[model samples]
Target: MARQDTPTNEMSLRWTVCGDRDVTVRGAEPGDVSALRRFIDGLSRESRYFRFLSGGQVGDAVVSRVLGRHDGRDIALVVTDGEEVVANAVYVVNDADEAEFAVVVADAWQGRGLGRRLIQHLQQLARAAGLRGMRGDVLSENRRMLAIVRELGFSTRRAPGDAYVQEVSLRLAAVTREAWLAHDWFQG
Candidate 1:
């Protein structure tokens, strides 16, 4: 993938995925509530179910939770295409050395490796926050998300008491070094 930078400071992260499409990712801010709503609205019911593990309509409370992050113990990231949010990733850090994470990509943006990029960005952010790992529970039927997590090297186990869900986790140090090595080799 190749990247070309632009002057969007609020969304400083830029990358190329799926060959040549450019995506700019950045931390979510107060101003993104409308964008977040629009992104959620664009998702299909199945897509929302896979991400939130629910079949009902997405509530404003979910948006508020995504907006809430006063203690610095949680991180929310959004990828944009200069107009609206196309993907969202978040991790809620616990007292332990790990965090619980979740991600949702717009229906129009699926299958382009955006999910993988979001997970990688989340891993980097979690590692910087002194987190040991990041984890999330995925519905068993959500094969696409499960495959993405597995491809990124996360380990999966059955979510307790829920035969339909699988819990996935990844150790930060493990992937951190691998990412560094890849970058180092590329630069050599």
Candidate 2:
């Protein structure tokens, strides 16, 4: 199979965290399994709980699934400091013109605005891929994530049949357009 070009800054994404920290946000490559594993391994139990709904160490099977290409429908991204993965995000397109996503940032990097940047990148990627919107299910207790999504203007509600989870979604055109406007405003 031929390789597709990974998403890069040419796509209008150049994320910087904490004002001066240069963070490279890009699509995950097939060869990044090891780095992905290391990143997951570094997550604290509580962080893993919020991310995977599982505590303690992340399983090998879960790692494998995360690293899979999934027939090109999965768009996985990572934010790295030099060569270390500090955060990760992914969205898998469903047949209903929407994609579901999950994002996790390392504990140390939690308050540095990386998650927002990753979501913005995903919104752009989803629009370019012709997706209508992106969605995700966050634990009801994951207030930080819920608040972030709310701040990003996602429409959210309790998931059907699951009071313990909340569903979040944003229209691709709406979000990516908002991001573009913010980018241009910053440039001006």
Best by TM-score: 1
**lDDT by residue (tens digit), candidate 1, 146-167:** 9989999999999889999999
Clashes of 1: 0
Per residue, candidate 2 scores C-alpha lDDT tens digits across 95-150 of 78887889999999998777876787677678878888889999999999999899
List lDDT for all candidates, in order: 0.82, 0.80
TM-score of each: 0.84, 0.82
- Which residue pairs collide in model 2, if any? none
- Segments in model 1 whose C-alpha atoms lie over 4 Å from true places: 1-11, 68-70, 173-188
Give the range of the ten consecutive residues with the poorest summed lDDT in model 1: 2-11
Q: Which 10 residues in a row give candidate 2 its minimum summed lDDT?
A: 1-10
lDDT of 2: 0.80
